[model samples]
Target: MRNRKTGFILVEALIVVACLVALMAMLAANQHSSMRETQDRLRQKRAESAARSAVAYVFSTLTSATPNSVTLNDNWAQLGGNGNQSFELGDLTFRVQIIDANSRLNVNVATAPQLQSLLVDQTMVDSLLDWRETSTTPRANGAKDEYYTGLETPYIAKLASLTTLEELLLIKGWTAQKLFTVQTDVIQSAITQTDTNNRQLPLIDYLTVDGGAPNTRANGSTKINLGVRGVTLNQIVQLGLTQAQATQVFNRIPFNSFQQLLGVPGLTPIAQQRLLDAVTFTAGNRVTGKINLNTAPSWVLQTIPNVTLDIANTIVTQQSTGFTGLSQLATLNGVSPTTLPRIADSFVVGSDTWIVRAYGKSGEIGTAIEATVVLTNGKLQIQKWDRLNTIGIPAWWNWEEEPTSTTAVGTGQ
Candidate 1:
């Protein structure tokens, strides 16, 4: 009887000990998970703060630059190109990149063939154009009011210009990857890739809604408005026109369009380009998707109708100084009488819109914000801000390769 009692007691004690061990294990796991989550939250807060600072820091370089000569070589573009430039803020790191809206093909102004350059087929182009049309009739290959309305989760066609580039996804057969993916591979070239690099970049990289602006000089000086004879004859002569040519050209306006000057006799190509730069006959404050000849990527220049690679390269080599943006291109080696007018409409000299992408990171946690910014009348304003949840990294930090550089950049940073 004594042995039986002792054996029972030992068994009960063993069972209790096993139960305590299991309970302790569960508690430890819960504590570990809680710690991890708290760490993640702290990282996130740091990232958010850094990302916002990056946007302000990067754009400060731009507002200080000369308006007419803003180009790919500018500090903002250099910092943003190829990869994100990094700056350290306290314990966190921030990255900033910039894209000129005027550098890309503006769907609002691009012709059908111009659209074709970015796409593989006419289906998306035709459907996109049809969607933009106010007319009820759809192109044969495109979806319109009827097709969109018939979907299971139906919505009507947008029937106008896209207010955002993301609107492309709403069109028939569009997908996220087709619009936003950026491919990575080894490549080398002297000219830092802007628009024309050979990479198979996503359409989103080459498309923007902010690609238009008021027709004025970069310094906010109004282009010499020629409508109703507002410009003086001497102003015309100063644009490189002969006295006879200036008088004839001056008398011809109240011109309907800038194209009218091309028809005037004895105005050389230099005068033609200078005249285009300094005047506008049309009534609107805006034009879209015209090339900023001073800054466009060589590939973008080639995309302009009748702009050959040689011509694009020639334009790429010359520097445009002062207020005459496109005038510098008129007398380039490849620009002849045959090529000038054909490609004339493709040129605009400066940009008012810049797209800023900034991300700040704390360890692996990150926050990104994309903003559309406009510079007008000597003031800078944010037109829109889109929190980019999945815009991805500018470039993976090679911390092991350059441990010192992984440190803070710049004195203030």
Candidate 2:
């Protein structure tokens, strides 16, 4: 009996030992997981802080510098330039890019011709017009409230300017995949060319609605300032003049009136009529929403009446120091005198608004902040702010993972 009791007690001791070993293993695993989670949280927090700091830095720099001296290409060289500027704040590294908002089209103020230049789909263009106009009547291929109400999850058409680029998804034909694609090579031929890659250009990259309501002419329409100084000869040729006639027009400058062009020898009646229809001599040069000569793309420049591809390219390349005055553009090699008066009212020397992108990274965690800011008379106002899960970071970072979340950091009117 004594031997039997001793054997049973030994078996009980073995069972207790096994249970303790299993419990210890579980505790060890829990400790490791908790440490990893804590580290991830710390990194994310640091990244967010770094991103905010980067944005602040850009705003401070812009505010302190002379507005006319700040060019999108020069101030934010990393955006499209060969080199990148990055700095470390403790363990977090931050990168920033600043772009002129005037470089993009303002949907609230864009004309049909201007919108047509950017989108290959006439239907999409008409649909956008229909979406913004107060009329219930639709254009030939446009969508109205009736079209949207017929969807699987019915909604009404927003008869107003788009508050966000994502609002296009609610329209008839736009989708997330179609809206964000990049068109690396875009061929601009005509408005109706279906083979063009303009459809692939992301709407977010080219449109804005926030920079204050544009100034309206007495005719109840937005006006382009044509007084911008760099009127090229090609732009003048587009005004119905032959190469010889345009050259004659190029030699003259600083015309106070269209009547002044009559003094140019061999000014034909047809050329005079075309010039009258296209050119405006009013000193209303301070119109709101004019494209910044310092940052507008060559294609956007081509949309101006007289600017051809070659002339537009020349204008972009010659603006290394940025045009402090329109007169500076008049000095380019091929600029025509006739082009100056016609386009004099169309451009601004500096920009009042800018698009700022700031990226922050800490360890494996990263975040991006995109903000649209308006700086008028040195007062800075943030119109839009978004936090992104993924952004095109510099190649040196070796970041390959996809973003985990996309959330709005904040928004303002």
Candidate 3:
């Protein structure tokens, strides 16, 4: 009874309450930590599942669309689910630029009006023309000789090859930013020659892109001729073919009917290989009279008669829910009666189509994982991935971080 009375003292009671509060706090802290860990693991698992689901969509739907190749050159429909709900895991809303890798450049194969219709800035077209002209010292419009000569490095000694698209920064009036705007759909890599010494050497044996056009020019002006010099071929005839030589030479025949070339016997192993490696054929415009609206990218849609990016993205988003035809897009949020006709002639929905997916996890710093799939050639091939920079990603995967944008972006968009 005495001890109990002592324990019931006001100070002791307050101490007991304080101890209880601290113990409770410690237990709560441990529970919170456990909860957070569980939530994080769930988030990670969900993200990974989303990625797999996205990949599955590409493999199934996109691959079935085409047997030849997958293209990332145009519009991408919504990949999975719809509405605010569509914005869930594996919910991919983005634009893909789908075109035959071998398709002729709209700017090059196009008539002047058609080139204008292709909907790129007039200035970009002008610069392209300037570069295509047979001028050694081609100065882009609005740029002077000093500007070309004033490069941090000397302008390429001669335009033996196209400088990468990124090199266009050296062009007058083209900033790095402007290049990004114009070249998003385009791929840039060195079109390296196997042998620079031989004029008719076999060129890019590994020409990528769908519909690999033979001798297609990067500028849509010049053509690559991967062949033996006619003169070299003639010289091969002067040397009598040993039996082994004849077999090796015959193996490298360029023409299916070599009966005509049989009279000339001098084809060397190298020359014969060149003939076999070369592709002289050209690719016609598969996109022809129709502009498949469903497949066109937002940029391509913007090029449509009067649609802006907002309207274009809107049209693209709406088309995901099974766009039967271009006309059906009139029901979209921003579509007006007047804009309908213009869009109709410009876009085609639900024809030859592919899907591009961009989904990733976000952390305090920024985007953690991102993937890009080009649904072409009837398979979902990863065009690029930017998460972690390598292995898990490819070099071309692009991630756009939340803009630190204090100022609004320009009208150029």
Candidate 4:
């Protein structure tokens, strides 16, 4: 048989070897793919488990409170100082900060200047003011048909009503970066509907006090200033109006209803709404407060003074584990006293909900996954959970930390 044709031809042997190699490669690749999927699934399961525990912890702590001791609407001062409680999971750590949104400017009710300060963009501030001023009733200046047609089409002449904070994106010069830089809550929406044409603009847009350019001096122009300041409110009672008059006007505004001051005398249409936007009257002096450990954006977190992006991110990543109280922040390598103080007022621990967010490992991927949680009645709940790597997030509740320990070594006994 000619020695069995020398077993096989070189070409045939080569082909068989190629086939074996191909099969090995396929098997190796399949194994790797399966392992990667399994690892991801495990990571997700672990993260979800941590989140549930965090919620349970939040509810247990708050619900166990004595009656009248901790009400749903209790303010910062009422909550007292932060404790040492913290939540940790895997490589994650979390803390809580309850803030009274009323104390801060409500973008919906804030004025142009207040918005400007919050945004820190002169052009954006000026443009918004110009639009509001020029767009009077039907035929406004800044954004009339003629003005809008000049820009890139399909041009939206004017926003009928700003239902969400993201609407600012339509306006010229406003970018996602610029809007988010100031920590504006894109999840929040505002509707400024003054039934009558001449009706006073809602004070919701004037959340920040009239500051910088349009500020009111002791002896200046005739413009009635609308600013919400501790000093201004105090002066309103002591100087502008009598104790009785101020009381009457003040009484008109109850919990979360400071916008009524738009009708107060001595206020221009702009000033009235500005003040209204700035003022938020809660039932008590203090109100519920919170900081989304996960969702607190960079700018807001950076406002914590020396907090670096890395530190903020670390805190965010650790959020699922849970946070007991405020001090755990010091555990971060870079966080120091200076940063803490600057950021302390900007954040609160132990009230309400939170969202933890992080970028994907690959820079090309955007908006990896953002976890949202709601803490009510002391329990933390996941209101919305999403992976924003694909479609953008929509506005919706509609409405809508950690540490270590030390012990004593020496004993007196």
Q: TM-score of every model?
A: 0.85, 0.67, 0.34, 0.40
User: What's the true lDDT of residue 152 in model 3?
Assistant: 72
Error of 2 at 106 (Å): 2.2
Candidate 3 weakest ten by summed lDDT: 200-209
Clashes of each: 0, 14, 21, 47
Reference-based lDDT, residue 358, model 1: 76
Q: For model 2, where is the 10-residue window of minimal lDDT?
A: 404-413
lDDT of 3 at 231: 28
lDDT of each: 0.69, 0.63, 0.38, 0.39
The TM-score leader among the candidates is 1
Residue ranges of candidate 2 with Cα displaced over 4 Å:
1-23, 68-83, 184-203, 211-287, 303-306, 327-345, 391-413
Q: Write the per-residue lDDT of candidate 2 for residues 1-413, one digit (tens) a residue.
A: 99999999999999999999999999999999999999988988888888888778677556754444345445443331211355566667766667677765677667787776766577777888899899999999899988889888998888988877768777765666545654443345632211123332344556666543123232233332234455788878876789988788776754555546545788765665455444544444233556667677666676666666777778788666566545455566655766765654456555666777777889878787778887666677888988875644632222233333232222210
lDDT of 4 at 141: 18
Off by over 4 Å in 3: 1-57, 66-76, 80-123, 131-149, 153-171, 176-294, 297-357, 362-377, 383-413
lDDT of 4 by residue, 25-121 (tens): 9999999999988876665555545434443444444344321121223332212122222334445432222322222333333345335334434
How far in Å is the alpha carbon of 79 misplaced in model 2? 9.9
Tens-place lDDT digits, model 3, residues 280-391? 2223422322344433445445544556668867755754443443335555767664454344433322223222333434232112233444433344566544333333
How many Å off is the CA of 136 in candidate 2? Answer: 1.8
Candidate 3 vs candidate 4, TM-score winner:
4
